[model samples]
Target chain A: MERPEAPEGAVWAEHVAPDGYTHRVLARGTVFRLANPEGGACAHVLLHHVDQPWERLNVADTVKVQWNAYGGHLLLSDQGRVLASVESESGYDALCGTTPKGRDMFVRAAAKHGLGKRDLPPSLSFFQGARVRPDGSLHFTGPAGDVVTLRAELPLVVLIANTAHPLDPDGACTRLEVTAWRDQPTGPDDPLWTATPEGRRAFENTHEYLSARGSA
Target chain B: MTVVAANAGWSALIGAGQTLTIVDLEGNQAVDFLVYSAADTAERYSAQDTITAQGNIFLTTGSVLMSNERNPLMTVVEDTCGRHDTIGGACSKESNTLRYGHHTRPQHACVENFLAEGAKWGLGKRDLVSNVNWYMNVPVEQDGTLGIVDGISSPGLKVVLRAEVDVIVLVSNCPQVNNPCNGFNPTPVRLEVA
Candidate 1:
């Protein structure tokens, strides 16, 4: 398959083959983008503080805290810090993908970083979503092209798997293109700095930790 | 009815359609719960699927506990604690030290309970998932901040769950001493199945 062109200013980019996974450490303020070219692909993403493995992505906290599952929302760490935020999104699917395939992909990625199966936590999916009907039953939306960018708020260990969403009626997935580029550090002047009181506190936590380490 | 001592753990195989009731013998105690297929431990409780299917974070009566495969492991047939938490994950030495200080590292926590009991069933750390905190109060503040405040449950308060399948139930009578989730002090609970 022909690889797509790298996005402008990308520090690095790669097209992960279908059913494959990738892991990398991205710096704070890096703009990490995941693009599903075929539109049917779903991606399972896991993140942790690049330096602190104990502080990892907490999907339940992300959904429970925001009360929404949109693609471009605050991705929170278990320790109450904003690891990343959806800077922009084209397709909405923040479903938690628990399929063995999705988890195994991350398991492989985690192992490369010296993390074991037990270290892997629940992950959030992209490019597929579901809605609750009036009857309390779920109605899954069809696959859609996912072009989402997440702004890292903390230096992060980004792990991603391009795998089929377990609930996808079609059960089809393809390659995913990931690109990382440098961006200006977030400051009080940025709208996202204090978007919401909850986000503000998360940012404060992130910033405080960074400053304590002399990274901020 | 089986009495679970404070800071201890228990596991059992509840038959399909059987009801298991957990009573907070002492008010304000947090009971961490998990359910897995008796025939296949791989199909363990999934907080994501359960919360996604129900469109609600707090579980109460009439809630169906969904598995990773999207099947019902159990249902909240009866609940008197009003609401239960599914997001505040089981505590561990790592989390204890992260939330509290490193000095609290030696304290026993829910993950240790799950690991000890789950190991008896051939389950390992990978088998555990986010668990239900019954009688524990975790309120999502208006600003979306989660607070582990004192419990809303009182003495004798219980929640009943009916196994939708022959299921293995694992529980940790939460021993957390660092938070208000257990009132900073753990206590005993009662369990009965019929």
Candidate 2:
């Protein structure tokens, strides 16, 4: 008998967070040990908010959480269904402040990550423009330079764009991790994505950002 | 090693074996993408299929990514580094307010760049789903957890992908500096495909 190969295409590596930094999963737990030196010191810690299944949030409920400019994590799970997004901030505090105001920032960021700017209330202000690639990597630079590469899974894989540095020796990259469940479990179209205002906002953001851009 | 160019006002086609590259000429950027079937739009990129086929969270070289209609969109033909985040999702206004503060809610995000460039293409919300963060490192713990870590890529690193079929690409250079994913300092990147 052979042990099953871990989920295919799973990634594993260290990560940063708010409370402190942990090289752990982008979801639960914290901290992961790096196998080499270039991996950097595992010191940056960020905060995360895991949605409670028992909580039944409806559109009437105040949008409980959002992730605006700061960098943080958001996971949407309903048994097998799930949707997750990460927010990037300009200032550290703006990313994961604990104060009600801090959490609000995450909520806003989450909103922007999940829903589109138009979905925001008049009272809610917003800025836009982040890029994502078909390979699942986001592009924040421009049309002809280095690109940051991001992926979701155990030991997640992040690649540098253009030059094949330590990350890409041949200037091309392709690896597989087996940690993620093969079954999609759930998707953005699922009702679970927008049961509450917050969820609706997230779904809205997802819809807006994930669409294709046309020639201007 | 190979380069592909998309004129500001135009688009190009990338066939299988022909990998398309998007570069962040500067730094600290994000790219938005839409994967459509060379045959039909109805069979577009399905984040669900991509995840299910890969059986993992993040994507990288060697990962044969699938589309919504169960078609292979693009294969991770080559990757410099080895970490990517599939669950971290993207940036937006609502997320800005929720993650930062209501005061910072108006800050620019990825969705804006996507729509600003995508609106004319006839793409809409119905086309959104699971996306891959190329340089981003969102790790999972032994107990099944996740978090964003520093990027595995440095300046000039590239992730190469071969289109299984003709696929359209959209990108937004990320402008976020608050997180370590960009070392708290969002920088520019370069894109080249041939």
Candidate 3:
């Protein structure tokens, strides 16, 4: 797979092969981008708060609050905190969780890294499509190769696994390219600096926690 | 190896042939659990496989946790808490609001606990699964309905599992306060491995 050019000013970048995984700790205000360079790849992503490690991204909350599962949304933390804002050009799958086929490949890849099951979490199936039918069954869809960019709301520890979605017809995997760069400072008028009512409250709560810990 | 606080999360990697015991230091604390293959993230615990193989929904002594691939990951070697829930999934802020009210939204839940603890090991929300609710009481009614009720366990009750493969175990000392599942209060639990 050919490597995609990193965004200008990118501080670091890496390409994850099929069935590979990578973990990184990103600073707040960083723009982290994951792109399926060869198409037909799924990058399962997870995030956690750097200071309060227990407050991590809540995928279910992300869907419930938005009332939609499509891409281009804010991923919320369990405390209603904004972990990251997701902007995807290729879309994501909301109905399907990680499948046995994907898990098998991840296991093989993890073994090479000396990581155990504790290191494996379910994924937010990126660049894949599936919908829940009225009858409760799922219908898989295709057309991969989307770039998903996440702008961090807080310092985060992120994990991404590159693998095939269960619904992929050929079960084939492709390479995933990741680019991370410090985002330009946002002014008060910038959307990134604005918050929803709930988000504002969450931010306040986080501030309180930090203040209590003498870290604010 | 760890003593998880009430409403907290804990995680560990248990190799093949190792046994891990969870002690309910205080009775009635629901311990939410998820397990994955140490070597493969995808080959994790499957509630469907375990339920199908056992022909039962409750986990107990001798019950083997089957992965999504229908392979055994861990076997329940001993149990003082006679039954554990296989379907009462980890609690989350969403579920708390849906089941109780919006007022419960700010409360910490099992999902947060799992994510927080699992993150230390590089695990995330995408890795959560239909977990085992150790010490939780979810009784299935004759009409196929399920009820999360007061637990039957007493203080010091324990359950043990022997890993069939190298596996990672993630746990949440369930912080649910909206229901009787945790007796309206969450408490600490003890974890020991041999």
Name the candidate that leads on TM-score. 1
DockQ-based class of model 2 = incorrect
* Model 1 C-alpha lDDT per residue in residues A66-132, reported as the tens digit of each score: 5454443688876668888885454344444546677778878988888865566678777776553
Worst ten-residue run, lDDT, model 2 chain B?
B1-10
Query: Looking at model 1 chain B, which ten-residue stretch has the lowest summed lDDT?
Result: B138-147
The residue-by-residue lDDT of candidate 3 on B90-181, one tens digit each, is 77875565445558878998888887877887777657766889998766442223457789888999999999999999888888887788
> Top lDDT: which candidate number?
1
Clashes of 1: 0
Once fitted onto the true fold, the runs of candidate 3 whose alpha carbons sit more than 4 angstroms away are A1-3, A51-55, A99-116, A184-198, A203-216, B1-194
Alpha-carbon runs more than 4 Å astray in model 2: A1-216, B1-13, B23-32
- Candidate with more favorable, higher lDDT: 1 or 2: 1
Candidate 2 lDDT over residue span B50-112, tens digit each: 543554546677876665445688887776666465455555555554344445555666556
> Residue pairs in steric clash, candidate 3?
A54-B116, A103-B42, A107-B39, A107-B40, A117-B38, A121-B127, A122-B126, A122-B127, A123-B126
Candidate 3 shows a clash count of: 9
Comparing 1 and 3 on lDDT, the stronger one: 1
Q: List TM-scores of chain B, every candidate.
A: 0.98, 0.82, 0.97
Candidate ranking under DockQ, highest first, comes to: 1, 3, 2
lDDT values, one for every candidate: 0.78, 0.39, 0.71
User: DockQ scores for all the models shown?
Assistant: 0.16, 0.03, 0.07
